[model samples]
Target chain A: MPNINTLWRTYQNLIISAAILLFCAIGFITAVFPAVEKIQSLLSDTQQLTDDTKALTAKLTVLNALDESSLRQQLSAVISAVPTDKSLPTVFSTIEGLAAQSGVSVVSVDIEGDTALATASAAKQTPEEKMLGTRTIPFSATIEGTLDAIQHFIALAPQVRRLLRIRTFAITFPSDAKPVRISLEMDAFYQPSPTSLGKTGAAIVTLSDAEQSVISKVSQLPQVSGADMSLPPPLMGQMKPNPFAP
Target chain B: MSTSEINLLKRSGNTLRTLTDLEDKLRVIAWWSLVALLAAGIILGTAFFYLSSRSDQLQSQSAQLGRQIDAQLVKEGILTSLKQRADVAKNALDAARPWGNLFPILSMIALPTQLKSISIDESAHVRLTMILGSVDDAVTVVTNMIALSGQHTIRAPQLISFVIKADGTVQMGVSFIPTL
Candidate 1:
């Protein structure tokens, strides 16, 4: 057998090559492979961040261009048409105004459905209402007037700013010279305001032409006012510790 | 030198040359592997740094935009709310069956004095009862209705009842769906 030194001299190049290749494999396994993976993950994250930035910037541009006063005015008009809540006073006054303008005498007015005040919790919606994305307050009214006056009231019911849809109406004519009496069932539309806003990166779109036309039509209709249009007086007295005590 | 002696010397030189060639090949391979490993490391490191910096820059930009949008929260809320309600109102308006158009049709068919009573329902069905002066008036109303139906103003017209009252006045009840 050859001595160790002799063996080293004969196989030294092979041994050196093997050792260098082993180092390359170990480096790949421990450092290079992990670094490649981390870089790929970072690339993906950076791409997502870039997209988010672009979206947010676009949203910011839209928000900046909006006219606050004009938006408020339009919003007010829309709210008056399909109010955020059941504006019972507004509805009642609107019916009264319609009666006065049409020269009809109101016999009775009755509201149907759950008359409970709307709470902070979400309102329960029927399947039809959910499908339409609107809640309705149904009411019926009986009025007596001439035939021409009744026709005028029917024509004007759906056009008022406080939007009303006449669901059913019946007019009965008497043989004698008595005024015609008509009973009408109507639906007043009201939708709750959005509970939460969308993400900051979400886009804000402007109204479409059809929507603008609807607003224009409703805005042109006559608006009615109730006597108590003022906001409730602010609490001037000291805050009570036990508000529910009384 | 002798021929056999010359051949042996040449063979010994060839053995040394083969060993040297083997060593050169091994060294070349090791050097190339080292160069490749270093190049991969440098490229990956540079990419990592670039991606990290870009991510940070984008995060800062998003934060700035968020602040700008936050300042107009009220206006944003108002606009969003208005758009939502406007969409609903538009749908409701479109769904409503307008009776205004039906009135003109009725007036054309019969005088208001003759129209004793009328009822309109959600299905766009109109039931009109009229007291006519004569049978000729009733025939004229029916012909006018057929003409209106042909013009697509109404559809499915039916004379529900025709009665001559004791006072000799013709009472007619007509039902039809107006295409409003």
Candidate 2:
């Protein structure tokens, strides 16, 4: 009976020692490993954020150094040539005026519908379009004039207020030395406002000198005036009385 | 001494030695276990404290950087439209091909040769068919075209053909692709 008691005591001691080791191991796993892993994850995220901040700071510094007014003026000049709206009437009038100046008589003016333009605009808004933001309208005209007048009109078409491309030029001279009948197919481009792009976050960029020169050329193109360029009046229902008005 | 007394002394000495050894072993085991438990506690506490403090510092830094980025973005908003406008303008200009500018080069080359016709395709490839008064004029046309290729405005001016007609006049054909 004494031997049995001694054996039981030894077993208890062994079990107690095992319990102490298990407790230490659990403490290391629950406290030490988790803390270390969290710290590592935090350090990685901090490093990534630091890199992003540095890049953005450098871009901001460069942008701050640029001449804001000059950039605005240049940008305005570019926008002037390619107005936000299509302004079809203005383009038509401008072409007629140019043709008249060149001594060509317009027999017929055909303006195509905006269906193709809508499709192209839709395509441009897609992700596949990437950086393309301009849309073009296609139209045709038939004019009658002398050979010299037709040639002069062709030369003056490019210098008009609205951009024009002479896609197809066909001339027919009558057998009896009558005036020449000329047919022209042209395309004009315009910009859609940035508001159509939804909410695009600010992007920083630098303009090269060559790009500035191109902007200067676009600005030098003649300006167009039409109803599309005008701003809408204040809403009649929402208008309040002006206190300062006489 | 008597034999029985000697034997009894030996037995007591052996038992006393065994008890003393057992007590020493128990003391050593207790000390080691205590030392191990204390070391583990200290290590876990130090690690947790250090890691949490460092994490707090890093989080604070990250917040500061985020605020700075937001401020910069706010400042950049004023120029966003202008930049967008300029980008569209630049793209428009890049898309245009300055085909009229090549006319002068053609005239320059045509005046020396008996130029018949010059036609340009939609892709801006120019085909020139000219009558040369002599073999020397054909050579001059070919050489001048080769030299024109050096200009940045044109690419790959190839002399397609040079043939002598029955009338002894040389007919030369040249094709050129324009780079705008």
**Candidate 1 lDDT, tens digit per residue, A71-117?**
77777788888887787888888899888988998888899888786
lDDT of 2 at A179: 72
Candidate 1 off by > 4 Å: A117-123, A226-246, B1-15
- How far off is residue B47 in model 1, in Å? 1.9
lDDT of 2 by residue, B1-180 (tens): 878766232447787677556656655665576576677667656755766676567657656654654444423433455556566665655555554455567655655237554555556677778888888878877777767777655687888888998988898888888664
Q: Which regions of candidate 2 are displaced past 4 Å? A: A1-23, A55-71, A93-108, A115-134, A142-161, A172-181, A194-204, A208-213, A220-246, B1-180
Give the distance in Å from residue B31's predicted Cα in candidate 2 to where it truly belongs.
6.9
TM-score on 0 to 1 scale for chain A of candidate 2: 0.65
Error of 2 at B98 (Å): 4.3
Candidate 2 Cα deviation (angstroms), residue B64 = 5.9
TM-score of each: 0.86, 0.55
Clashing pairs in 1: none
RMSD, candidate 2, Å: 9.6
